[model samples]
Target: MLEHLGEKLILHVTLGNFSFSFDILTVIMSWVVIAVLVVVALILRRGLGQDIEEKPSRTQAILESLIDLLKGQLMSSFSSDKLARELFPFVSTVFMFVLVSNWLSVIPYCESPTKDLNVTLSLALLVFVMSQLLAVRMRGGIRYLKGFLEPYPFMLPLNIVSEIAKPISHSFRLFGNTFGGAILVTVVSAKFAPVLVPAALNAFYGLFVGAIQAFVFAILTVAYINVAVES
Candidate 1:
């Protein structure tokens, strides 16, 4: 296990003369997370088939609180309630997916998808693209373009560089934290203390840190949207 600390299982395919290498572990783990979320969503949807309840069940109460929390974060940044309502599905999904991905480490023999740079970077890029599109939508194209030159004409290049750095920084922050936690757990568990130590570390890193990182990522995504529209 120690020998394979950072190694990935690659799946290679050849189509005619071209060959493609894919990180099979990351892909598999990512899909596992997605499938789990899908199943949960289906169950929840079926539950919704019941008549509306005046007083919420425990599960419903918890879910409502979570929704309000995410919505409140969006509403705080976006003054328009309609915009917040529209954006809730996306932001909430992001939070749930990431939170689940991070928590994957808690399961025995399962690793978090976020431990892979590709996964985190892809997520960051998705948010980056969405933010750019939102900016263009909320502030007209001309105004959005003009944002790069604000305060001083010479600031355009710097602004462009800043925009380019967002995804890089966003992705690396998550990748580093999750990957580092994984490595820490692996190394300590393999070479040092046994069951109890590893269990404690896994709970702390996989659950607590995972939840915090997910929330941070979601909040940063919302912050990017706020900057996009209000910049």
Candidate 2:
């Protein structure tokens, strides 16, 4: 049923003292996403303005708007434009990747990678590890570890739990939203006879919800990074 529903496409490989089972569809979709992003990046790169007085093209203007919006979000998180611009590439790419992947679910034979718990959880873990590493690198290991003991040592356990909860929340938020929407759309289209209603619902589910969730995820990630570094 899982395979039939396109939930997971499994394949296995083994090596010395280790083995792995992976989703082939997710692997393919991830590559597709990366390819799309690369192409967009190239187009944006070519569309960049070269002269101070040159009028910007529509693509350039749209790209500029995207950058500005992302920069604003990052500045809100970091309280510094310099820091936001410095971090924009990583943060903005995360937003774009998730945004594109989530929106792709509307196309036939394409599933949002977020529909798989493994993909979302892995991304969450990446964010978590990056946050902790940034905190440690900025504060030094001793100070970073000591941070949990601050405001009285009794808060240490709670702080530890809070840090661990971040990735869990991040993963589940994206997974639940995307997965539930996919399930609902599937059920509605399968059980009902209406075409227009289902199409509208799918558009809302794919475009609006997908975009909002992507934005939220990116914003939360920036918030986490800022908190980690400042702590």
Candidate 3:
């Protein structure tokens, strides 16, 4: 258990003069999270094909509630219903992926992909790129470029720096929380009472903190895109 704190199982590959390496555990856990989300999405799709019932089943209720929740969040940020609907799929997918990835740590012998900086960074970069592309599409390329010169010409450098920092901060925020929680849980389980204390802590950190981090990441993605497309 103590070994789980900071150690990483790294795999290296080499071909002639080229070399590459990656964290094996993070890669496998990420695939596992993706597989879980895919299965759930299929289940939801199958459920949707059924005829409308007078009363919703548990699965139907849960699906409707989750969709409503995500839609509400998007609507709060976007004044245009069409725009909100357009962005819903990406934002909701991000929320589900992050939530599932974060929760993976709660399973025995399984770790969260978000605990790895690479995984979180990839997700953050995806959001950043998507927002930028949408901005350019909504605003002309010249207008998008001109956004950096807002208020004063001298602010261009500052604006550029701020834009660069978005993915860094976004990725690190989720990575720090998830990684720190894993370390704390491992230490408690190894040093203190292994059963009760660790279990309680895992529940709090895995479920509560994980959900909050996922929500924050999703909301921030929406907010960033909103800012990009706004005049």
Candidate 4:
């Protein structure tokens, strides 16, 4: 039953251990996303200036607005503390990457990298490890273990288990939503004839879902960092 369902939804492509399988449209969409981001980065780097007289074009204005928004969100969560300063770059990069990937899937032949279980899982694991390491560093070895004690000693086991589960839930939530959207769009496009209608629908889906997922992911990162860094 699982195999049948997967066969109906996914388009598998294998090349040795390096295999890529997803909705065909999503796979193509992912590439488009990567290309667009690269182009934007290059344009910004070229156009960015030392002199006050150098002015930004429309692309620079858009990029600056996005950066400002992300920075503001990060500041809200962590304030201007040392930890916030340290973590801001990593968190901002993750947000932009996920946002771009999610939005890319709205294009006819593209898919979000967040839709891939491997990608989401890897990101979650990175966050998990980083958080734990920060906690350990801040509190030292024995005190870090003592963090679970909180109000009562009996809750230690449960607290430890909950900490372990956080990454799993974080990764699955992102991957599931993105994959579901990709599958839905693919099915709709296939069932219809001319692709313009489906493309328009995809644009809306990408706009709404992409922004929400990016915000959620960034919020969770800030929360996790706060938990780890605060006593």
Candidate 5:
């Protein structure tokens, strides 16, 4: 059944007790996504002028608008403007990276990295680590750890379990939706000779469903950060 998955997918590596594996396609495709974003950023940067009153180029305006949107979203989460600004780079980067990764499936020779369990889990784990660090930094270490016992000391274990589950749940939600979409499209395309059907399916899956998952993942990261930093 896995034979239908196009190209060389997984590669395993081992070194003593440290065993590791990754999707070969995901790694290659993610670089392309990053390069494209970097190029767009450079082009947008070129359009900006030092003079405030000068009219901005379309690319500059669009980039500025996106930044504004991200800023507003982050601002809504944090009480401190400085903290919000500090977190904007992380939130915005995740949003753009995931968005690009998802949309790339529409192009030939590219697949959404988010479809890979490893990729989604790694992304989710990043949020988990950052949120925990933010909590420790904002609230003192002892206070942050002690907060798990809130409302009752007996809840500590349950709270810790729930905290651990956040990343697992976050990762699987994206991986399942994206992986399932890819599998369904593949199976249907292989069985049907029609070109239009597969094209439409790809379009809907790549654009609508993929984009929604990316947006949710990015926004949820910010939401988790908010919960972490909240007093």
Candidate 6:
């Protein structure tokens, strides 16, 4: 069944040592998610009212509610209102992007960007850099390095290893989950060749896997930021 899928619906793009092969439908589906996000951002920025007198539309109200929910989560983690305010945009953007990407995979023939190792790695690296920068900014240069020594001198090496492992784990967790889902769906569709079966699988993908991945991504971001700020 898997072998048959390789011949039927596989999408391939190659450059030098790097090559990507997946279902073309999945690739296009992923991009549609990206496109939708871009459009939503633009629309919200333009349509949101500048003052209380100009009431926001229903769409704007819904967007604001989502942002407020994220804000509340960040606030609970940060403890400092000022810090939460400052960090809100970055955290919010990451949550929305990951949430959308995960949910997009449920669309028939669509592949999630998070399913690609390269894309997930890039996002993890960005978060790693941002976390380090936040740590340095909060504790200063030398203090940031000294942070590893906290609670005991003997634990420094272990702490260092854990820090390095963070990005690797973060990237692979997301990549593996989404990629595995995509592969499972592909194999199932090929084997069953039944319309309703794929739909049921997609419902599970959208309702369960998508929501869990989104929550995990957001919570992890908050946890990492809390570590950086509190260290």
Overall local distance difference test of candidate 6: 0.77
* Model 3 per-residue lDDT tens digits across residues 126-147: 9899889988999989999999
lDDT of 2 by residue, 112-148 (tens): 8878898889888988899899789878999999999
lDDT of all predictions, in order shown? 0.86, 0.85, 0.88, 0.76, 0.84, 0.77
Residue range 76-195, candidate 1, lDDT tens digits? 677566767788888888888889999999998788999999999998999899989988998999999999999798999999999989989989988898999989999999999867
- Give the TM-score comparing model 3 with the true structure, all chains together: 0.92
In terms of lDDT, the poorest run of 10 residues in model 5 is 1-10
Residue-level lDDT of model 4, residues 1-231, one tens digit each, is 123333424688889888876656444555676688788788886666656677876667777887788778765687447877788788987787788988877654445767777778888889999989988987797998788897689998888888888889888888887777766666776776447766776776677887898778878878886777675
Q: Rank the candidates by lDDT, best first.
A: 3, 1, 2, 5, 6, 4
lDDT of 5 by residue, 1-231 (tens): 447574446789999999998778889888998899999899889888778999987878988998888777655667677778798888888988888888888887678988788888998999999999999998999999789999699998999998899899989988888877887778777877457887788889888998888888888888888887884
Question: Local error of candidate 2 at 169, Å?
Answer: 0.3
Kindly give the number of clashing pairs for every candidate. Answer: 0, 0, 0, 8, 0, 4
lDDT, candidate 1, equals 0.86
Scored by lDDT, the top model is 3
Candidate 4, run of 10 with poorest lDDT: 1-10
Where model 2 places Cα greater than 4 Å from the true spot, the runs are 1-7, 14-19, 80-82
Alpha carbon deviation, residue 163, candidate 1 (Å): 1.1
* TM-score, per-candidate, Cα-based: 0.93, 0.90, 0.92, 0.79, 0.90, 0.83
Q: Which stretches of candidate 1 lie over 4 Å from their true place?
A: 53-58
Candidate 3 local lDDT, residue 91 = 88
The TM-score that candidate 1 achieves is 0.93
Off by over 4 Å in 6: 4-31
